[model samples]
Target: MPARPPAATRRTAVGAALLGLVAVGGCDLDDLDPRSDPAPGSGEPSEPPADADADLVETVVTALSTALAATSAVPPRDRAALRPLARLHRRHLAELGADEPVEGGVASMTAAQVRSREERLQRRLADWSVQAESGELARVLASMSAAVAQQLALPAPRPRGAGGGS
Candidate 1:
């Protein structure tokens, strides 16, 4: 028989063969192409049922009002600053014909807490806007969401100085 290749050479050949087998074995010729995957809202209803959209809008309005009420104790300047945001939500609620009572009681909240609540409400409004059945309603919700988001970026009012001094 012909002399066998050096041990190192044999080991190298075996490793190469094993690597090739593993690489080829892992590949599937019939694998689905990700590029062909269906796009969201394609061949399906993009808008949610009318009643569901109405309910979601009502819920978002209520939550925003509740949050506004909760921030009542945050300095007067801050509270005044937040009123416009609450008014905007109310306007949207009126436009939607959602007459739900603003639920929940007033609770003191830090500026950070107010910001957090506004952020959450903004996100919820955005989601509801996406699911709204009527284009007009969706536009309103999206506008409200954008307004709330813009307010969130504004700095909270500074507390009045204890002593009136320079």
Candidate 2:
């Protein structure tokens, strides 16, 4: 029988054969059909169709209103400071026409907790706005989101008698 090639020679031969196959496979010019390319305008990114959830929007508004109302337990000065935010939520509830009864009672929370809740609500509104089907509703949600974000960026109100002169 003829002596088999050395292991190294066999490996080199097999590697060369595989490399030749890859090079040939990569030269398939027929795969570049222009007709297969995405049509003009079709490939351009577009916003996903809105999936409006009216109930969800209503629920968010209610939760925000309740949370703002719960801030009454905070010091009078602090509560007063939060009044604008509360009013905003009230306006949102009215605009959203959130007449559905909310089941739960408001939970007592500190001023910091209230701020955190507002931040959370703002984030939710922003996300919902992206999914809202109605352009007007989405715009409203976006506006509210910006308002809440702006409020969050502001320095927390100093508690009465906390170092500043009376």
Best by lDDT: 2
Best by TM-score: 2
Q: What do the candidate models score in CA lDDT, each in turn?
A: 0.61, 0.64
- TM-score per prediction, in order, is 0.56, 0.59
What TM-score would candidate 1 get against the native? 0.56
Tens-place lDDT per residue, model 2, 35-77, is: 4445567767455434345566666666766765665656566
For each predicted model, how many residue pairs clash, with residues at least 3 apart or on different chains? 0, 0
Model 1 per-residue lDDT at 113: 75
Tens-place lDDT per residue, model 1, 1-166, is 8998756554455455445543543322222223344557688544432343546656766776676565564656566666766676666556555574453476777666777877888888889868876555566666666667656656665555635678
